[model samples]
Target: MSGHRTRKWVRVAGTAQICALLIGMAAGGCARLPYTTQVIHEDRRVVVTLQRETRPVPYSHPVQLRTDELAAALAGFSFREKQRLPLRWFAEEVPPKQIFRSDELQAVVPYLVEGLQKAAPDERVYFQVLAPGMNPAYEKDTTAGWIALREPYLHLTLEHFHAQFPVRKSEQWDLRYPALPPEPKTYLLYFEPGRFWETDPVTGQSAVQLREFLKIAIPASSR
Candidate 1:
């Protein structure tokens, strides 16, 4: 089953590659396909592989970086450039249904925060972004429609927690967690955004998209 699942992705990836080529030709600009290169949680880093023009490009370019650095890099890229990275985090208008419905993944927000605190102790963690909304503010709470959370070490199902939590039309928040030493560790969580719907161009995608989620920033201190 694992091998079949892997192969299925490979085939889907091939199809996406062809689609990229078609779209790139139409746009007359570099077309890129998203792909995963490597994910090292112990190092708190994930690298994505990309390809363009039948040439190998950094799809989801791999980098040795903390969560914040990852988030910043992802947000800074253009939409076209973003296609190169196979990150699920994107600012789409449609809600991520596929992830939420999966039994393999679950959301437990407060629990995640508590666990991180227990493990890291003195570290101050802050959330840069989470569901219902997305913004740059690191301290102000949401009005009523959105929710966001930032912190030191990003726990698994961080998105699931926010999504399942109550919120109005849209929400956004910035949460900070304590800091930890550079010593290596591995954090793992299964993220399932169930039945992905079309992205609303205006909103892009869910407040927490695949690319954005993987870019979990572990800050040194809270602002």
Candidate 2:
């Protein structure tokens, strides 16, 4: 089972690598290629943004979703260390760039379907790939493309939390960093939680447990 998951991850990573090549060629303005590729994980609700290091610009659309609907969906996929949920996701692009070859694209389909079937089989999963906004250099100018592009990010809405609380006067001293030139300092936090699997009501799915992943949504405070 572990081998299967590893293979799936490798395939996804390979797709990303291929897309990177397509982006390079398209941005180069080779009429022969005529297009660039972008990846969108609809279920993850994120569009991978690509850019050159020096010219940092938003070359893609923001990942978005209905917050209300997202919350309800998340509630159904309860986090447990022992559970393994299959997820369905995809890649797409605007201006029609062929980032993936037939074989690569074919490789992705099953991986996604299987993942989704295991994670949220009954739930709807969507995907799209898009080219980002036109770069100034590549605006009307056809020449001067082909540059080193950064690695596209895999945007996943794994999980996040928000905690609200008032700090105590005594604790305020510890929060300040007088030794660090009055600049604010942040400390790392860690959490250990027990996990187990329960049947999901919305999708009627099950997941395998590997490691316990935890996030401290709301931190406890004495103040």
Candidate 3:
């Protein structure tokens, strides 16, 4: 069968078959994807956040760190890892065309679906993407009299994710970062929990309530 045909078949197979496949793999002691979970208690409800680093730099031996002096010299070049909460149902963004057949999705989707269904029973889940050069305002200013056009491939990509996951809603956004050179090359995945508006009695100001937030950074080549 063609590769596309195979993926179509897999999607049609649904979650039950996927769950059974996972169970079989678990029985063989196969390694699953890496994830961390965190639990938060606020508003008298337990909220969990599951996170996984999508573009982890693999460990490599230092070429010049054999001596203590050399190690000290290179210390300034190191970066601190971002801290994330560990919880069940970690979701990561897959590149545009790869979501349907990605090995990572195959490994994690079943668990993600099950966790959300059980933990946040009534909450609407989201799968969102943000791509570069998609700024509506920027495009409007530059194109003059033309409607801002989104990349056709990106539209198909969003549709693919909608069909693949049990997503209550899906969306795409444009990002504007002034400090860094526009990557024009990265895609971001966001998992947003349901939101609510609250008014402060003291200040009389309305603000949005943040339940949970997680993001996955996917590189351009991955798409």
Candidate 4:
């Protein structure tokens, strides 16, 4: 969760440590990281472009991203209100609201994964997730962001997320701006490499990973 998207990225510091989450599962699961030797790959298009590079971003062998899984995960991930309610409370829990939808995820995740592989040591993979405005006359609501692999930790930063003002101009128009889309709280969750890496029982070596975690819950999938 971050403040209204700005030019600044919200950095999650002190996160280079190995993540032990799901270590047992990985040890038995055998899911490997999508890494590549070509070290440089690019996908450029009218709306976006992504490059995945390695060097400054030190990575080992075998780069392959399960773009489908990644997209599904991104499509499912959401932001929810943080307030705690008592068990006796009569009100229902708030639903989780997704930041991106299925259609957008299908179009965006592949490029993002590819770009991460082609990133320059100092750069990040970037893109904007968009939603049409409620009013036809306005610009689309957008969530602008980037993803970077800072060694042990991968960072996803949403720098600018803002909804456009719907304009209705007239002498007798309502005297105020329309309400914009709801924004998310700044939340940065860290899962160590262990969360992504799994040990191969047969090879006695750990297979690296580019991973995603998901929990099943219905979400309001929109901005």
Model 2 weakest 10-residue run by lDDT: 141-150
> With candidate 2 superimposed using the best TM-score fit, by how many Å does residue 144's alpha carbon deviate from the native?
43
Worst 10 residues of 4 by lDDT: 9-18
Runs off by more than 4 Å, candidate 4: 1-64, 81-93, 150-153, 160-162, 165-223
TM, every model? 0.16, 0.16, 0.17, 0.42
The residue ranges of model 1 lying beyond 4 angstroms of the native Cα positions read 1-54, 58-62, 66-94, 98-217
lDDT of 3: 0.26
Cα error, residue 139 of model 2, in Å, equals: 52
Best by lDDT: 4
Error of 4 at 162 (Å): 6.4
Q: Model 2 off-target regions past 4 Å?
A: 1-60, 81-223
- Ranked by lDDT, top first: 4, 1, 2, 3
Q: Write candidate 1's Cα lDDT for 79-116 as tens digits.
A: 11112223434523324332222211122223223322
Clashing pairs in 3: 36-86, 36-87, 37-86, 37-87, 38-86, 38-87
lDDT per model vs. reference: 0.28, 0.27, 0.26, 0.45
Give one digit per residue, the lDDT tens place, for model 2 in 118-162: 222112223222222244222211101111101121112221111
lDDT of 3 by residue, 1-223 (tens): 9988876765555445557778999898986543434222112111223333233422111111112221111111111112244521232221122232233233333333333333321121122222122343232111000000011100110122211211122121112111222112222222112132333343233322221111112233532
Residue by residue across 1-223, what tens digits does model 4's lDDT show? Answer: 4563421222221121123334656778965432333323233211333334433444321233457645644553444333444731422354445666666777678777776556556455667665565665555555655555443333454544444533333222222223344454453222232355444343333332333332222233521
Candidate 3's TM-score = 0.17
What's the true lDDT of residue 89 in model 4? 44
